[model samples]
Target chain A: MNDSRYVSTAQVAEVLGVGVTTVKRWVDEGILPAHRTAGGHRKLLLADVLRLARQSNFPNQNLGPLFAAGHALVPAHVQDLEQALFVALERGDGDLVRSLIQGAYRRGVPVDDLADGVIAPAMQRIGHDWETGKIDVFHEHRGSQLCVAALHELIGLVSSSAAGRRPLALGGAPEKDPYVLTSLLAELVLRQDGWQVVNLGPNTPLASLRKAVNELKPRLLWLTVSYLEDADTFLTEYRQLYQESDRLGVPVAVGGRALTDSLRARMPYTTYGDGMAHLSAFARTLSPGKRRPPRGRPTKQSNG
Target chain B: MNDSRYVSTAQVAEVLGVGVTTVKRWVDEGILPAHRTAGGHRKLLLADVLRLARQSNFPNQNLGPLFAAGHALVPAHVQDLEQALFVALERGDGDLVRSLIQGAYRRGVPVDDLADGVIAPAMQRIGHDWETGKIDVFHEHRGSQLCVAALHELIGLVSSSAAGRRPLALGGAPEKDPYVLTSLLAELVLRQDGWQVVNLGPNTPLASLRKAVNELKPRLLWLTVSYLEDADTFLTEYRQLYQESDRLGVPVAVGGRALTDSLRARMPYTTYGDGMAHLSAFARTLSPGKRRPPRGRPTKQSNG
Candidate 1:
């Protein structure tokens, strides 16, 4: 296998001589470990892709450059700060949450890292607590609100929001999934990477996502599924969306806790790993240095 | 009917010589039509209530002073401004939407009225367009984001957001319903009535709702159902919530388009009418003089 850290599910399917449906079933069934993009695309790790190929009775092959590695970008201080952020959220301290977020950004912790490492995990913890009955509903809801407010504040602070043609990305949660925090966090991360983003917010239907893809012709699309009770329906829509947006060169990224391993393999799109860092890395690779042109210019995105 | 415009489902059930469940069955089974409150409580028009009773073979005995009336509260100018708001939303003119809202508030169109009449209708129309194919997914999503942004701006503009000791109201969409717009609008409405609100946002579970009621001892609790694919599941939770919170004096107000006539009857809670005007009026009647002393004071709510 040639050098590349990430391979599309399609690439793996071809190598295995299996249909995309079978590949997706593998991912969904946890046969292959994969990551999802913010746009709901699935990206397979090189090792996992090769593993799937071998498991399907293919000859063992040496994967050289294909197995690229991603180094950690978030520092220890940033990790510590994430804990502080969580405390503030649990306390329902909007001001404290804001302060910690602002301080992190000031300290040079990338905004997206803050989202992926701090905000996302903190919310997950809170959610877990709610599920386990450690905290009451009021506390959980309060934590959710504080996180939203913090992100809203972070999004506001982005200096180089977007002017015109700076590698635009658009996405949101699928319909029936009201989780907007993930999509909003992705928006912040993309903005920090200097990509102008349009977040479709929570409970977004496929019709709307398709409309956005057509109208915006975004360079990258983000789809996150935080809630997934109706897997069959969601899978059908995901597959349909992947097929519909095929003509466009724009890459679709799908991720979130909802993407089971087996499900990821079945998805025909790129999968993003956990956190804003992976997404940021993906953005860098897709359109390297796209954010360089208009550094620190506060302006609106002109219609392309 | 003693000069009351509304009656609880319990009263209706008593008059019909049936259990509350049976009365709810009438509503749920399409034998009756009723409305819901923000707190998930059901309230029927006195006329409707009486009609239900009569249809259940209720004695022709008069409801007497038990029946009352609720007058319309939305003004003509507010209605006209609603049309203007729709135009702005269609144009995706964020600035114009903001300016129109600020102007409306300045001209004495209460913030809640703007929510109920202007913003809600405009959003509904946009949603309708999307449903009918007058617009595509992009337009609908864009329209939704615009409405959210507009409300955020309006919420920001409300001076003296909350003062101490005001009637506290808490609410959000039920679990799996990611629609937070309604919850936010309800926040503005409650705040205008001198109620300090904690909007739990969308997809809030009943356990959390119960927790909120216990902690806040709020005067009112609001629950909205914006999207409901799992009717049986939603109804089960709604009914359970009503039962669980029965001990608390805090009235659970349930309202929204998703509250079908039968669904509202089955759910034992106060039902609110369409628009913020009705909600604001409900707030006033729920806690009269709550806003009188702090009238126009842009201060944080003092604890009662």
Candidate 2:
């Protein structure tokens, strides 16, 4: 493994005959096994990028080596769109807000980029303003509602494009969590990858998750922890949830800001991701059909 | 005795300073009484149409008698767009499908009209084609997904425009009912009337509804009856649901095609609607603050 064997995302896109954004999405999703430079620019390993270019002809691109060495198509960013959206949110222009979002999605902006890059920072600003008395609670609430609605619309819009029975995915915020957005983000990201995903919504009890597990029988269950008052207390509450999930034989994946190092160590059975992108990447590796045993049948491990 | 009380929907629309589609929607929703002639042309009762015009000025439109007397606007029937959507769905053009729906909606075509006139009929055609072997199950399922996704996107789009503290409204299809779409339609309609709505999704158990009512403390609960295998059995199942809703002090409203006159007569606590438009009109009349007492306390009626 050569430490210096790294290529810029643009070079990867050129080698793949796709947009830089697409290449970045693959790298960001951990699909191409890329690393970041000291200045925080994405740098894909040359061998990994070349291997990916070879493996995923994508059936549509039909590119040869010459095309693989194609020139970079276009640059990607929403420097101005983000500002326009902030103003639109403040003014509460629902139509423009949606159009802007839809346009971005159409332009190939990945859901994770929309969530972490744009909305997250914008939402942080809005929250900070509300905290410092720069804006009223009503204004903040209205802003929040606009963002949530946009996400819901975007999710619904992309979800329609799924042509067949995609992977089954279910997720929601854990009990006492006010953070529903992350779950929606996860749903959108998963759905974009052609997963038939459902969000259980915020403040979901563990029993409710267990019930959903039994009913929907989803292949993957995502528990989002947006906040934790006490790491000890949170771990204590979710430990039983993990045991129940294991008993039910469902894969449990966890993520969010509150998962401290100690808490994560204690719940080592769970898979973790930093955000929607990571979760989506992990989901790509799961197969619902192969993972679960026939209903009420003995596990293959047990049979063995 | 006035047989000439009936007028074309266009005439009614012209007199109301609204589009022809609005009149047709009003008639279709049972908001204003109307009947179809032998040629299947919608003819509204002049008296009923006038009464509705008097009642619904709708904040933005400043139409007195003069606006009603204005020239006839564009033609109504979503027929052409529906045909286009059929092709789009057949070809799996997601963007075109969404564009068609959004364009219709932007042209002042109400949600109820879209659901009843376009999607319902198009879906029927798709189902028929599937049954006749004109298309495969994959085609039918794909078409259904497109329609459902459009609805979800539409709901999110409209729900964002609501301002202020909206009355909390909750709804879903009961267990074993494959009627998720109706619940979503109800959500869109209610949200338009400044109601904070939550759709619990299809195949919801009564126990789940009960649990949601207790937790969310919604002012009005909508239980959509999309299908009933046995009227008597269905009535029995939801009668207990009505009692649970009553116990929780939340009013239950039921709708959908499966409802029969005989079955409906037994459930006196429920309000019924033809589709989304009527349900929206009904939701407008609810007052959450005045209707229920503070949570965990006895009802004012009981305390008194």
Candidate 3:
């Protein structure tokens, strides 16, 4: 192992402006990946440290020592983010992928663009590679896991922005859709614009969604169809959900690769989005200004 | 709706050591629950604000202004935490529930205690209420949703502490379990002790676990069976998984409400945990000191 290629725990702590204990704790928790020396000292690759610093959005001047130490930080460009993300996912370097997305967002890349341009394409390429036998099934599963982790972190970061009295947006992947990324992205995108979201997550049956709509009474309902187990069952149940949403006067935003031209033609969604940009745009139309009050149904039992 | 009982966003910002914009953002994102005045100003109840402060672990001295406003801040006792959590969940107060859990954890409550003492009993009460017709199904669902959200937030907070070269612990809820909280809690408890966890989430089939074992080769495995749809299938599949894990020398820790005493006799596990405490104790036994390298299988394709 090349010791010079890695930085010590204290060096990373100083760079990130945190105590050494915090850095050590972060490493122990698997937040910051590190290697143990023969003498049991923790060391981190300079590249990983740089990624962490960038993701934390620390000032450039604070990272002067890192550069002075002879390690180069290859700044990822917006155009190359997708490629970078793809490589990170392929390597199963979850922290790197997280930092790339979060660092870009903190640097002012819009959520919709990140979703539509970066993650969507990178994940699509991963899928394509799997289909062509370029990657193993485990590689593909690992990619999804990395993506989900990154998205959850982003959601936590962005969630503080969508405050009081916002219109609620409830959504999930359809039954057998199985993909968690698209639905999670939808939550993040809507949340970026300050919509309260109840993400039912993947494999949500349409009947449960209808029940959710009746119970939660969200202003908007979004569905991401990644893979359908049975097309006929989906079409029938989805149509029922559409009619239910229509009766409740709620707008539905539908998207995902599984919603091909043929499928779109048969479904009755208020908006069909090709990407997060479209979802962002469509959701904006039903923003807080048009917030609808819950129906005049009898209120459920109160805790009081 | 009483203005006198409410505090402005600025007041919350001051107490929490953040900017007014950040407070507004938290309210917008539903991180902080707030009420909108007829004049369009955001005002939060004093109790809710206190919950937020406590959850954030802000010092009491900084909360002098809030105290002077003539609103009492009820200091939740350790014994009362479960009751408070139950009330918050019953009211569908996700933010409060999150604040309660996060605040307790920050104040030195162990992860295992929080899982076993606070969350489990509260959720169990909610389940009992639903069964006895004391609460509607939505109330039960809402409780689960709130619990999941709180657990995810706590996971994100604790993740920074578990930094380097930790043993990977992989597991999830079995197919038809459909409960996310137990599996997530398992992840948090393990992560607290510096374990790298890959929680496959609810509804994970046994075959998927077998595949994951072959690929990830985790040092340990855990399954939280909150609900079982079919006994015979789970038994057969679970037996196969137990044999596989045993063959690979991975310890399996099993728990949850659905794992009845009868089911235990039928399944084979290295350890059977009744609560998070048992899981936590069992996991510590297999800590990094007993670290095992990946098996002698040929290394798969590397991103490098």
Candidate 4:
């Protein structure tokens, strides 16, 4: 029980092979085990810091910098990206928001994958923080604006890619859903899955959606409603739309957090309960020409 | 588009073969599709009601009695049970609480599976509701107590089941986690998977967990942490525990939302991301004597 032992933040940084700023960030995020000296400088426990260094893939150095960078080299970084995006949005810093999305995309992060991995989680956290009064409504709105802009930019990048299978997939928030994050994510996912997506954006009118379907002739129509209270209104309109669309032989997929109970039962279209799972299933469906291997085939694949 | 009709609650209920009370409850819970007339009575579209009736797995006549009893034969009735348990907990109605647990158990739902299927989902809904201010703090606490009591009762019943295999399993809240619902679900899942679980309950000190491990000699320990802030504390303690326990030849299995970060790092030890998947995996691990037939070899038993 050598509790008397201590190490400098620099030593911790050395152990993790990261810079002092990174170590400080780790301390700020509470990733590093630390104590403060009488003069208020951070002190690290030698044994604990060493253990963390070993556990973290910090390139065989002190763990301080890696901790500060908020678990860089892992999906955990996405969490930080999410926070940064939200903060940038709150401040209405369009430049910062654009930079973040561009940086992630340049790093080979798929726009759709980024939506699922980074944007969606960030939006969820922002909403939670706002609801908990950890953040104000202004900040939430700011974050949303930034999100919309980022989506717009990302959608442009998507348009540059070679279109794969479907001509178009339409999705957006039903009239009552204020939060369009799920819809945005769905649009990004479908676009990446090689469908030309006509994103109607949030709170699109039902009549407009029907008109869009008639005019755009999307191969699939996707609808997202995040409020259960809106389900009846949605279904009432949906039944009419489904009747008309069914004649055109287009399949409709509906999903959102608000889907439960009679709403789930009453909707004749396909429903997805979870966002990412639904997107993955949709992607699988769109990946044409890939067949399931016959039974008993030995296969070797690298670990992810 | 015949805008000429609106269905009364009775007519809608008649179509579903359910009592108006049940339809109202479903509406209140945002489970059913309905609207209010000028006088405020509920109205349902005929097509929507029929779709719900079909989805509920009830004959038109049966719906009336089921609705009268405030029940529906939906496959996810187990989810409804969870909601009811949480609602009873929220209301602090001890009688309703006790009856739901008893009914579920006596109805041949495995006590543990009932916990997983009913209790966990209910708790999630409760948490979400509480966060959204749809339910108050007192209700949340009441719901938590009911779930804890239900788990206790189920554990007792499971202990008496001679037909069940009991693998040694440990359960406890990860550091800083106030919510015991996850740990409770883990205990139920383990028990349902035929593992005898030692539920250490909420917020056990790390040292106490170590001592219990030494005394109980459990083959596997389940740790759950939900809050992001607690991750650092849990990880530090868990690393030490893992090191010490590994020497004693015991493996610790961890899950819950907290394990999300740990998954990316490829940490040592097994981690379950999904409760059902985790339970099935644990069951498979325990039942090593069972094996699937070679691929493409048709056996007398159908794997399906």
Candidate 5:
């Protein structure tokens, strides 16, 4: 392992919101493990520091600098992180939300879990709050916008690690569906599964998607329908899109809140995903070749 | 002025893609200006280095790292940047597109100019190429995806500087209109002009927007109609939306390719922005309190 993946004593102190002397004391007390550089500067593995921070019950807010540091992969507890994200998002703290989510991903929480387990639930609760008048529309909008911003940041991170040669998956929300978050989350989940995705984003027409199928010939085409203005029209247009994709031998994956059992019953697709985890599992079956992690994949350790 | 805004000689060399010795030589030869720290380490003004980069005809590609540096502001030639962006988008170089656009915004190019003068034109050409069969659909999709990604990055950057107390502008593309770029560009322009925008994004039904207006009571609303599947329905729904906004005392800004002269004559809007520049100017009129840049706005120098 590269020693450079380890951070200096000063960085640990800064990340944990403590003094360097305290960090040194922790190292000396065997509370944390450390190695010494040639100049005798104590270098601690980023993972160890994170573990100690977790055990010592350090506030997740203090881990903001750690997340922004973009250091080594250290697996994080998913339940603790989900709760942290809920609090951060509720407080309208966009920076904290970003740090928590990005930090978890960097530390080896899979993107699908981040989507299905963390962000989706957090946003669902926020949406519920908005519906019940627990939060004002502006507050809800702000929270959603912050989530979109965080997801885009995650997309950039995932894209940087992705090999562009992977099988193409082109997708977006169908017509009259203006939900940006679900589609973005879907893109992130598929991207993490090693598919090169061309996310058309929200409100893509079925006709345009058919043209995309004819031209781009993506290996997979996904539709995330969060809202449907005219279900009859959607069904009709979707039938045509399905025919086009079938003709091109491309499998269609459909999901989202609006894709109720009745709606999905009429809309035929190769797979119906209830959530990002389902989509991720389906994507793996499509391209088992990419089941292996990309080269230079970060080493991760579970609590077990 | 904060001298901290100035970067060190080594930073200048790294940004310029040159050696430190060469940068030192340039300073000594009076080709570039520098100030000395107490330890005699040379600290060059970032603007001067950027100006030198432009004048010396350094390849715009080499400016990638400079753009990523995110340091001092220095005015850049917009035409040169437009050309650079066009090439980068055509080549599917998303990172370069991001760096060029973000760099210009950091260096004092208004978001509207970046939207109108740089990104819009570049994207128009790419769209034109796709129509003429000069490029494959995958290439066009890739380019558009890259633009979306870059714009989102700009949104995050602008939002960080936004006060969040500004007038809210809630809007998106109306139903059957599935364009993402124009709406996102509008959000960026409005945000730069001090609007806390809640961009509902593409394919939003006018009825739902009416609900948002009722609840949010935004100061302004914007609709970018890039593609309209049914003009008469849009006209009817938009009329209802206009009446609602009028009752709520919210100004409506409308623009996009689908709004032809005849269509526009039938559609009522507080203002019809032909492009982002017009939107920026109109936003300024609504909130002159924000005509001045935010506090700690970077001091920028122009080559003129």
Candidate 6:
């Protein structure tokens, strides 16, 4: 017991009742905080040991200060913008979104960069919290409104160009799911990749969409659906649309949480999984060239 | 057809053969890049639409370049360092671990922060690629080694005073389901929460862990098992361990992908679904005296 000066990873495992390799992995992942002595031996603090004992039974306590202290121990600028954005959304503060975006832009963060780094992550956290029941429906709705309004304003800030960029069709499933944020993030990512987007705001009728396709002759349609409940109905409608659209040479791309399900087999189109990372990939597939490096690529970088 | 100068969101949706609601959601999510005309009508670029159409069938193909583009879009100062670290890991450059740590530290970024923000994400990407056969086992091993070494060195830089801060024990299940990354991430999170961590690494023998618990009497034992294949065995062993550990007055905390499965019943122990967020909550649980704002309380600052 007196050997508390320096605890071997094995001893630490014994204390925690875990395997030695797990301890090493924790060390490797920077999970278990440790330090080496002048002689290069690892040591663990006593207090942390006690905290671990309590953590198993009780999580969701306030350890912010402890984390803050630990963060202070490590050197780096902690990005708290996402949390702030979440709060702002809950409050439905379009003004706050504007200010945040302006601030990020002033800091040399691009519009798309703001969308990806700040807006998207913030939205995801909000969605996750809302889904987990940590935040109520009203709070989630308020946040969504603020974000959508801010995004609209951001669209206004970016100038309309006549660069002959290809047009994209964007929309999502019914309001019951209410996850338009995924589509918004996708739009931002596509715009960043130099694609021109035509965002049809949520809840458009299928007949109207078919008519638009017949009239406008858009080359691609991008759809976002987050709920699995409407999968069977949506697929039935999608099959009809797909069969019709194929004749017109217009392709449809589907994405969001719903697409992750195995039911995708019933749908004829492509499914993009969670995150803008996948959305951007879907957008890229629409472009006719082989995979090209972003910087050296020939496309003009639009502020949109 | 001649109205190509401006396309209504409705028209765009029709062109894509999807419901207007779907299109609007895309617009709202920023998935479909769009510009509003002076009258506030959304316009889509023909080229962008065409590109989306071409890529609709192959979503996975977009991953590589999108990831590359994302890395490129990060702030320049961090970009080179991040890329170098990833490349080193990709190449299995063992010395690069120390060099990257030193470089980041010199630039005022803590090694832990770098690992969390950059290294971990990169590793996830590499792991995904490895799983999908996009990257070979060699690359995966190389990246894992570099990360392991880098994290170990980073832990070495902390002061012994920090080592005395708190004690935590970290471990996971056997090697056939080797997912030490989760444990590693958990350890970092706990450490950041001011707990001193003893990482047991991976594929640890259960008996040895029990023996360690007897010897060290550490406060907490963290177990991570990421795969589904070992869930039944793990659960059986976990029940036994729970009974045994209960006798010792130590709690077992469980986490990783497997914990979320519906088939698995909620055990008596705590389960963390999200990684860092869960760890943060776990830390708070350990320290009851800390002040936590109500879930709905508005905070002024943002956390990214």
lDDT of 3 by residue, A203-276 (tens): 77788788778878889999898998888889999999999999999899998888889878988999998998
What does DockQ come to for candidate 2? 0.04
What is the lDDT, from 0 to 100, of the residue A67 in candidate 6? 24
Deviating ranges (above 4 Å) for candidate 6: A1-80, A91-94, A105-117, A131-133, A174-177, A288-304, B1-304
TM-score of chain A of each: 0.68, 0.65, 0.73, 0.62, 0.71, 0.59
A236-295: candidate 4 lDDT, tens digit per residue: 988887776787877778777677767678877754546655764665575463435457
- Among these predictions, the greatest TM-score belongs to 3
Better of 2 and 6 by lDDT: 2
Cα lDDT of model 4 by residue, B76-167, tens digit:
36777776776676655544765687566544455445655776777787778878978554345446645555554444333312222336
- After superposition, the stretches of candidate 2 with alpha carbons farther than 4 Å from their true spots are A1-81, A160-164, A229-233, A247-249, A287-304, B1-152, B156-304
Rank by lDDT (best first): 3, 5, 1, 2, 4, 6
lDDT of 5 by residue, B191-211 (tens): 766677777766677877887
* Tens digit of per-residue lDDT, candidate 3, span B183-210: 8889888866657777777777787787
* Recovery fraction of native interface contacts for candidate 2: 0.05
Please identify model 4 stretches exceeding 4 Å from their true place: A1-77, A83-95, A110-112, A161-166, A287-304, B1-304
User: Model 5, range A49-123, lDDT digits (tens) per residue?
Assistant: 654553344433155554545532323677777778877777667668878887787655667788888888888
Which order, best to worst by DockQ? 5, 1, 3, 2, 6, 4
DockQ of each model vs. true complex: 0.15, 0.04, 0.05, 0.01, 0.17, 0.01
Across residues B214-255, which tens digit of lDDT does each residue of candidate 2 receive?
766888998787766666666676777678788887888888
- Each candidate: fraction of true contacts kept? 0.40, 0.05, 0.04, 0.00, 0.15, 0.00
lDDT, residue A218, model 1: 83
Error of 3 at B299 (Å): 56
Q: Which stretches of candidate 1 lie over 4 Å from their true place?
A: A1-76, A102-108, A159-166, A227-240, A243-246, A260-262, A266-271, A284-304, B1-81, B87-108, B159-167, B227-246, B260-271, B285-304
lDDT (Cα) of model 5: 0.73
Model 6, docking class: incorrect
Candidate that scores best on DockQ: 5
Q: Lowest-scoring 10 consecutive residues by lDDT in candidate 4 chain A? A: A57-66
* Full-model lDDT for every candidate: 0.65, 0.61, 0.73, 0.57, 0.73, 0.52
lDDT of 6 by residue, A1-304 (tens): 2232334565456334445776676666666677776796666553554355354321211121122112222112225655666666665544455456544443335555566567777777877886897755434444654565445444433434436655554444433444556655656556556665544434434544555456556667666776546666766776776776778877777766567557776678654455566666666677763345467533422243
Task: Kindly list the per-residue Cα lDDT of model 2 for residues A66-132, writing each as its tens digit.
Answer: 2222222222476566666676666555556666675666444666777766676666667677689
